[model samples]
Target: MKFRHLRNEKGISLLEAMVAFIIFSFGLIGLAPMFSLSIESNVIARDNSFASNLIKETIEEYQGVGSLPSLPFEETEDILWTKPTLSGESTSSESASRTNIFSRTISLEDNSTDASIPNGVVQINVNISWLNLYNKQKNLSSTSYLIES
Candidate 1:
């Protein structure tokens, strides 16, 4: 019977471990921008969702009544459609606070010119604009047609 002596081998060298760490760091660096972009996209999506809800609610309010005013009217948080104004202009009507970042504007256009629709039909256009975290201007708009009942 012959006995053989086994030598101990190093599991990992310091150089190998450092190289692995460097490679992992590079991978993380490559993914860093994607993470930042994902956060930015999430914020933009949230703002867009809020704007969409605002527009929908405004349209529903008018549609719920099944009636639209003959003249152009604007509605905001502070001012209602019932308020009489010299011109159909509104400022930051969607949000009550003046310090709000978003500015919502509603405009109405008479669509009676379109012979296809009814005589008392009007087109409602809602625009929402804001400055994003990046200080860039972002805008969302929606249009709906309403007929006087």
Candidate 2:
């Protein structure tokens, strides 16, 4: 009968450790651009959502009136929201005057289309414009027809 004993075994070598580190660093570098793109997409999406909500609210308000305003009327206004004071208390009337990042314009035109369609129809145009995080201009427009019932 013969017996053999095994010596000490070494762990990972320095070269293997360096290779793993290089792979990890490259992976992170590749993901860096993806993270930036994701952030930009998120900002654009949020801005678009806010604009859509504003347009919907304006339309609803006009619909509730059940009657169109004077023909060829246009109204432009800056969006404003409450700003909290340093004391963490409610906002005052003056504080409410602070403008937000968005601006909306509502334009109403009276007229119809081709021969089939009748006249006296009102066309409502809602334009929303804002500056994005990258200092680029962005705009969204919504159009709707207010037909008499």
Candidate 3:
């Protein structure tokens, strides 16, 4: 009778510990994906910020050129392919390619870079868009005035 009681008590502790371990393992598994997603999102945001700054700088340069380009609107490609395009219009996909976080459209008010719109100011629009891991789309944009030289 004494041996039987001891055996029962020993098994009870083992079973409890096993159950707890299983529950803990499940919780950890659930949290893993969340952690990964957060990391990816952070990376995406950083890349997009860099893209924005580059486009903004270009807009400023064009405006300072005294006006938008006459014919092609300055279709010149950047040194780095940090600007993505589905049409792949650049000389090489490597020269004007950026992360998928942005869909940029740089345009002057009248698509004219030859002269300031009015009041000695030019319009610059920068649009940036991204899709997170969850397949949800999001975007941010900014507009500014550039002075014609």
lDDT of each: 0.70, 0.77, 0.60
**1-149 per-residue lDDT for model 3 (tens digits):** 45553344434577788999999999999999999889888867666676677677766666567446543232323232344445646646555234344455565554344454565555766665556445577555677776555
lDDT of 1 by residue, 43-97 (tens): 7787677778878887787778755665567654422222133465564483343
Best by lDDT: 2
Query: What is the TM-score of candidate 1?
Result: 0.65
Evaluated against the true structure, the overall lDDT of model 1 is 0.70
What C-alpha lDDT, on a 0 to 100 scale, does residue 30 get in candidate 3? Answer: 93
Q: What is the lDDT of candidate 2?
A: 0.77
**lDDT ranking, high to low:** 2, 1, 3
Residue-level lDDT for 79 in candidate 1: 20
lDDT for each residue of candidate 2 in 55-127, tens digit (9 for 90 to 100): 9998777877767777778999998633345665546655634334788999877653333335856777899
User: Per-residue error at 102 for model 1, in Å?
Assistant: 2.1
Backbone steric clashes in candidate 3, count: 6
Clashes of 1: 2
